[model samples]
Target chain A: MFEHLSIQLIMGQLLIGLINGSFYAMLSLGLAIIFGLMNVVNFAHGAQYMLGAFAAWFLLTTFGVSYWGALVIAPIMVAIFGLIMERLILRPIQHLDHLYSLLATYAAVLIIEGLMRQQFGSSGMPYAPPLRGGVNLGFMFLPWYRLWVVLFSLLVCIGTWMLIERTKLGAYLRAATEKPDIVEAFGINVPRMISLTYAFGVGLAGLSGVLAAPIYQVSPSMGSNLMIVIFAVVVIGGMGSIVGAVLTGYLIGVVEGLTKVFYPEAANLVIFVIMIIVLVLRPNGLTSGRGTST
Target chain B: MNSDANAAPLLQVKDLRAWYNESQALHGMNFDVRPGELVTLIGRNGAGKSTTLRSIMGIVRKRTGSICYEDEELIGKRTFQIARKGIAYCPEERAIFSLLNVGENLTLPPVLRQGGVPDSELLKQFPNLRERRKSRGTLLSGGEQQMLAIARILRTGSQFLLLDEPSEGLAPVVVKEIGQLILRLKAQGYTILLVEQNLQFARLVADRHIVIEHGAVVDTLSAEELVSDMGRVKNYLGV
Candidate 1:
């Protein structure tokens, strides 16, 4: 007798996996960009993501902001915070050893988290989904918000890729990764690019947070634990490569989902397990990766 | 003064002052890279040859000078903006994006020049790249990577190309290959500013040669004068 796990159950897991993958892809891609070219492990990424969720929650609660408004305003606001961090903090540490950047970001994460805790307290608060109700798939019930998360996140990811890979600004960004001085010589201001790149990258994480608010409990330390999994995803994807981040994010999420079906215990550890396999097989990743570090 | 049909210099540098941090490199230096001319900034190591090129490119952050590229003031402009106005730099480090393949390295920024040259032109010039088309830049041999770097800029077709010691650490045969490449670029009307210690390569490609000792232009001479005058050569380049 077959253990008849229905198509509905399978589809549900698939949807969950894809949604989780969307956030993973966004988070890890940003991590890859920052780590690859700048060579900084941005420990603040999770905190930044949490800040984004808080932005959405704050806008909604205090200003009666619509989901649409929070979607745009939250990311821009978080990006401004990111811009300040890059200009005031990250820029000064550009030339220091790798450890300095790590320490700097770690300090930033702790401080941001602490400040958020002070203001918001320790409890998690629920936010209503912007896109309400479930879409009826023949096999399963798919939530409209979850579907939006996958679709919108992919759109943003593609948009980012187009910006970085297809445009003149992207050329300079990729070029900056190769020869900053040569790019500088070409009369492209490298510092401004660095700042913009930081802001754009952090902005991606913020957008993910806004998207995540309805799904996740909004709290100060929401970003804290999620970062560990994303780091593993980044490593598995290869550091600093955008495509790799996206791919690994989805693949690992699916694998984790499948693992939950087969063996529940392994589900939580699946990403780290994949990281081990990748380290042994290809230190890089499935793709060659753009100019960002691998 | 800008390049003119009647009487202007192609590029004019007046009191070009530059520094790294507080340590000044170019001290009131003056020079010109005439239209369609190949000029050499010849000097010993730390003689500011490279600094001169960087300063002209507007890459030097702490720089004060009148660098006229055609009619635009290059002093205050940003680096890529300067490049958009028709100037490119090939650093001494041979700063190729090792992660990219040979083909990508060639075509990332299309030639700014209006010659309508395709990447095929680059392949024709350096057949080696075609041979290593799929190879990662890091996988290339020293000579191959150098050729790729130079070929990359040529594809861009920028009016002015600044090449910093393309022959540094290259074999004699590779140096000859580079000399031929530069000559080919010059023939196509690419204005080149070459910084070099390879006297032989400089002699082959340069129409006018100038020496920098301690960041100031100690002497400037035509190629003919350089061939004949031994005093400046012996004093500055020690050759």
Candidate 2:
């Protein structure tokens, strides 16, 4: 491996891998949380991410909002949208089979994607990076914005993990996920907790979108394009395992990045191949059955 | 025993009918638990004894008819609301969260009122749980899980308790311990409606027993009457 590749090339690919991993960690974490508590696959998650990016773009163009402002506001707007969707559409069909929610959220995806395409067209829109400098790390040049994204995403991911694993509210969530009716009998408002959980999960997707806007082209199809890979990430991580989702996300991202460096043709197909391997060897996922702990 | 015959009933269920989808689990359940009384609902398997407790907690959503707690209607109210009005439930399966530790399970239910037993007292009452405080619910034995199910609700300060099969599948010694615990709870003036298949255990701890068959109350017997008519009670239980 060292014979063909320079240190700079390896470092550069690794940095790119980490950046992609950050998005994967955030998006898959959202998916895992929603699926764990709500039992909904949330097929509309990709659309929600698109909506988050668009919300940021719209805020910047229409109201002269800064990148900082969009960061704070866009996720909140997406969360509100998630809250409404969960209450009006998902809540009614909650008693139905998992396929029902999958289809319903898929329908939402089509509707949202159609509207965004009509409004913004299929072309990718450019969002200016907030930070404009790069540092020479001796091995490779690193962008300050990329470093910020990776660090910030790590913070958010760790914060969320701690919130779910350590806090009192998290205890309620974990307990309710196991037995909602029993938790309700304990005087906890479980239905409300469920709705809020869905909202928070989408809010995470929205945050990921804002982070990705400056790196990737913000477009109506950006989220859907990335969604296939995200589903693969979730499967490899396990369906409802929170820690599995987060860890598998970053791992797959790095693996894909390394593949691009070593075997460029297999970069796109590597994660799916790993998914098949994981499915064959460990059907429940790598970190499942630990009982919600990482 | 604080059994005042003229005192208003704390909980009154009149003609309560519940369904699980298309199948009816409870045809019509009628019972009353007076304040400070330890009542038991005794019946054979599939006799809707568990369903009756579920109906009271509003866990069975398709229930019709009235469940009045402290003279307030509870049929249309949500489970949490019913709980907020000072009622707690311990399910048959001891549905403890396997993800949570014993301590977390113990304190999971919020304190609904000020009179709830503290964590220290609950640990003292079930000393086995004290040793397993850091262990997850999955790590607990059958008796420990049952103790956790009953112990968790004590912190809620709910005067009314709906316990389903607290002694189910436990050792005889553990069952006796549970019976003693129930007697202690009764002495503390907590109004409990227990669903038990073990008539001997029910007779030991309960002040009154309501015999259920096919979702309807067949007989109501005081502790004295239960002993006097043991043959009739055995017939109702099909033992």
* Chain B TM-score in each of the candidates: 0.93, 0.97
| Candidate 1, residue A288: how far the Cα is off, in Å | 6.1
* DockQ for all candidate structures vs. native: 0.38, 0.81
- Model 2 residue B216 lDDT? 92
Model 1 regions lying over 4 Å from their true place? A1-11, A135-140, A280-294, B1-37, B44-48, B58-78, B81-86, B98-160, B167-191, B212-221, B229-239
| Candidate 2 lDDT, A50-122, residue by residue in tens | 8889889889989989889999999999999999999989999999999999999999999999999998899
lDDT per residue (tens digit) for residues B75-182 in model 2? 999999999999999999999899899999999999999899999999998889999999988789998899899999999999889999999999999999889988
Over B1-239, each residue of candidate 1 has an lDDT whose tens digit, in order, gives: 12233546678888899999899998988888778888899998998989888888767868997989887788877777787777888888777776566676667665555653578777887888899887777788888888887777765557788899999998999889889988888887778899989887888888888889888888888888877986768678766
Best by DockQ: 2
Tell me each candidate's RMSD, in Å, in order.
Answer: 4.7, 1.2
The CAPRI classification for model 2 reads as high
Query: What's the alpha carbon RMSD for model 2?
Result: 1.2
| Lowest summed lDDT window (length 10), candidate 2 chain A | A285-294
